[model samples]
Target: MTTIDKHKPILVTGGTGYLASWIIKQLLDEGLSVHTTVRQKKHKTKYQHLLDAAKQSPGKLKIFEADLLIDHSFQEAMTGCELVTHTASPFKITGIKNADKELVQPALQGTRNVLFSANDSDSVKRIVLTSSIVAMVGDTIDIQNLNHGVMTEKSWNTTSSVNHQPYPYSKTLAEKEAWRIASEQNRWDLVVINPGFILGPSLSKRTDSTSISLMRQLLSGKFKMGVPDGDQAVVDVRDVAKAHILAGLTASANGRHLAAAHQKDFLAIAEVIRKKHPRYPLPEKVLPKWLFKFVGPLMGFSRKYVERNIGYDFVFDNSYIQQDLGLKFRPFETTIEDHFKQLVNDGLIPDKRS
Candidate 1:
């Protein structure tokens, strides 16, 4: 019932990010005017890919500077925007020394700041918030207690804390805060796209993305001896971007939409890479949980995380995004294939030809 005004600009936060870059590209491909934000205008060089994406597309692009911690930083970009895809949030699992300061505050406050801008805007009617599957379940083991051993939109991460699983904890706090704020408003509706560990081609060559870093570590034989039993609910980044657009434009789309495709472990990921480059030193097996439990702490993961997540299978029910948004997920093989190809093309990871 809802049809977005194509002429009206859509605002996308975190334009230079791996996932956000894909979202912005799709919007431009659709010939929709997109206004995007980065931390500062001086960093415009990082967004040349976005500029290039718009070159052949009919869509118009505008760049703005905004900060997550600064109040009203997103207001100017969001002005006259009927849909604001708030994709600006930190995602990091390793090297987090201060959870609250480094992860939680920015996510919580960035969401708050964006909502504040929306509340003041007369044009914004809906917000498609980018949340994660981690916000639904604290650990892979938590899904075992679900009704059908599948994580759903109804799930809430109760196990994560600022100390343990702080990244998930930050997403949980931010999504919870969003719901709290939306309850007090009437003019706008909030739609959440809760995707899993997003994988696939990134438009930019930046190495800061958590997914990119993980991909690099895997392809570089960092875990050639063996990878942990950790599993991921994989979803294509392109599909995730489509979910945001559908959630914004589809009038009937409501509540949280789980945007994942498959439930596979780290070994499965390595196997997919091996198909293209078998000679590369890819993991052939998973390390024993008992052994990983001891070495987990040495590799940035806490002993508690090892106990709870390792040797567990995490399954998710993605029926909502598919049925509601009419989203068709890309194959896992395609996701990994395109991702590795992009990395190799950019020399982010050298292509080894034997």
Candidate 2:
């Protein structure tokens, strides 16, 4: 493992994100100075928690303004930093008017802009990017084509595009672009952490990302009618953040690491939550696939998509992350329990069990 010099500031893009905030916190705990990038410096309220963390930690925290669409915006942040953690990729499943403009361009171009600056910086040794399981396999049905029914780091997403699986496609292209840029020059090594459906408490109250927003829906009684039958790979936000830090400092770590715990469907989550807080409007049953096929389109899901995916089994070979990075995963049940507690603590849901 490469020894991290505490004096050198590590750059963390999208520092305000749920996962990135945890990464910043862990680095601070290690007495490593952190340089974080956000779009606005004027938003002090958004970063005050970081200041709180810094005060209690041995590390120093510095924030700089940077935009993904703007060229060279991250240059100042990347300058003089020995390590970079790029977790700023856009993730939105709905309300996107232009998928290419909003999702594709920012993700691919952001990697270029950040890596270009990192290459120019003399101190940088490695970069850790926050990728998603979406980049590993498009849907649960992808297991059928796999040799061992496990989605590993060796796999690449083959079922995404602007027209379909747009979010996954953006991640795949962005990671590929990062590799392409890294190969063109040997200045820095790249490590990608591909987590699946990250859950647990979010530092910020914002519900922009799909995971946090899904939590909002659960607490808001949106799924009280019936939970979707679709399954997903799950991971904790804290674990994902820790993997990023481990990947950065671990010298032997390279390529992609799948950071997921297990495969579970929406009904599984509802069952857990329902058991914890019976008074909450948690769904008691799974919606039928036929219903999903007929009504899913009205809810914005494509009919073809509903027919092909959902209500299936898929596996993620997270063994490489534990073996290569020497990291351990928290149980999936613990993630759900902690996530529910956070929702209640944040007032997103009331303490019904009490």
Candidate 3:
């Protein structure tokens, strides 16, 4: 691993996101100057926590306005930074009306915008990209096709497209685009963190992402009846953030890293939440897979998605991240509990456990 120049500011795009927030926090905590980009600089309330963190920590923080879809918008923030971390991308799973415009374009073009900006910058030496495990396997059933039932860094999501699992499709294209751009240049190298479903406390109070939305449903009794039967590869938000830092600064950090910690079903997650708030009627069992296959369409998932995803086992190989980054995962129990309590502390989840 090479040394990090603390004097050089590291750029982290999409500073307001669930994962990006933690990334920014760790960067600041390490006393490194951080240059972060938001869609708009006027939304002070949206990023006030970051300013607060900067004030309290030893690191200097500067916020710049950037639009992911806008060409060269990230150039100002990325200029003169030796390390650039791209964590900005739209992550909506449901309510997508136009897949190409809403998901694919932004995810793909955003990477284009950032990596191009990196190319324009002379000081850049390394870049860390935030990618999802979905980009490795389109759906859980796709896992069955893997040689050893484990997803490695070599896995590429070939099953997603504009019509099916478009979110994963977007991520797949975006990461590929990053690597493709990196290959054309030798000045800067690329490192990718392919994390599974990230959980744990979010620094911001936003519930925009699917992960936060799922946690809300689990705690707010939306899934009190039951969640669809499925197993998901899961990881802590903090661990993912640390992986980004490691990848950005470590000279030896090359290629993609599968950064998930464990694989667990929905019932196991609910059981963790229910240990303290059992009266909230958290899911005690999985909703029958056969039933969800029919109900999935109404919930916005395609019938094929339900058929392929529901009731499928989740198995992952996260050794790449563990071995290269020397990153350790937080306990699954801590991940669930800390996330649940954050929602409660922020009043996003009410005291309806009675």
Candidate 4:
């Protein structure tokens, strides 16, 4: 285990992101000074909340400007930091016009740039990467090929590319690149956290994250007709943040940790919200698979892909995270309720059914 004093000033990339913000909060609460990276230092006003938190806590906060694609952009921020948490990665399921330029290139290049900086930084001891469960298995259909019913850290996403589930493909390649680089050197040990769909209260008012956008769609009646017959291995955002810190400080922590809760389908998620906040118009029915055949294509989803994925079950063995990092999960119901309450309080959602 890492001693409190041995933990040097940490550097967190993508500090403004929905998940990374919580990681910063936990670290600061422990009285550890953190140096966070942003695209522009002039965006200092962007992280005023973090500054405010630092003032009340015993820790300190420093800001630096770094771009994922730009070479040597992270050098200054990485200097003398003992630990680095690389959390910045593009996450968009739609509106992507170019797969290479938009998804793949940046992810691969970003891993290289950050790890190269870690190699040069003498003070850095470990690099913890924020990966996703997407890297563990590509799609629900992949379960047929495995002997075991569930996915574990030993599994790798073998069937993913820009043509299908491109987001998962990007994460697979980026994480592979991280391991490839780490194997060549001995300066910094690498640890990766592969979390499933993250959901919880937001640290800011921004609604750009896909998970948050899903909540917005639910409240706005975007899918009032019905929802696709799909399920997600959900994990709370705060739990994921706690896992990251635990992995960083734990001495024997040296591999991937799958931070996920029990699997739940769309109807399951909607049911939970409906119970807590009956005012919200949560989706009630599962759209017919045949109807999805027509509507899926219009929504930029391949009909064949939907047919293969819909109504399938995918399980994850989270014992590794529990036993190794000593992670305790928040009840899935609690996370759902917390996020829904925050939504109503923020005025982004109404207290009555739409």
Weakest ten-residue segment in model 2 by summed lDDT: 1-10
Number of the predicted model whose lDDT against the real structure is largest: 1
- Residues 1-354 of candidate 1 have per-residue lDDT tens digits of 445676899999999998889899999999999999999788767999999999979899999999999999999999989999999999889888898999999999999999999999989988999998889999889989998888889999999999889999999999999999999988888999998988999998899998899899998888887988867889889999999999999989999999999888888888888876887778888899888888888889888898888888878788888888999988899999899889999999987945
Clashing pairs for model 4 are none
lDDT of 3: 0.88
Off by over 4 Å in 3: 1-3, 352-354
lDDT of 4 by residue, 1-354 (tens): 343234578888988899988899989999898999989777766777677778888878898899999999999998878888999999977777888789988999999999999888888888899999989888887866776778889889998888888888999999999999999998788999999989988877677888988888887777788998867889999999999888888877879999998688877778898875677667899999889888987877787678777767777789999999999999988998888877878787767734
Q: Model 2: runs farther than 4 Å from truth?
A: 1-3
Q: Estimate each model's TM-score.
A: 0.98, 0.96, 0.97, 0.95
Off by more than 4 A, model 4 = 1-7
In order of lDDT, best first, we have: 1, 3, 4, 2
Over 1-354, each residue of candidate 2 has an lDDT whose tens digit, in order, gives 455565889999999888999999999999999999989999988877887889999899999999998888998998788889999989887666788999999999998889888887888888898888888887668877987877889888898888887888999999999989989987688899999888987776666768877876876788777877766888889899999999998888888999988678776777777776777777767878888888888877887678767677667778999998888878777888888887777776667875
CA lDDT scores, all candidates in order: 0.90, 0.84, 0.88, 0.86
* TM-score ranking from best candidate downward: 1, 3, 2, 4
User: Which digits, one per residue and each the tens of the lDDT, describe model 3 over residues 226-284?
Assistant: 78886788999999999999888776887999988878877888889777788666877
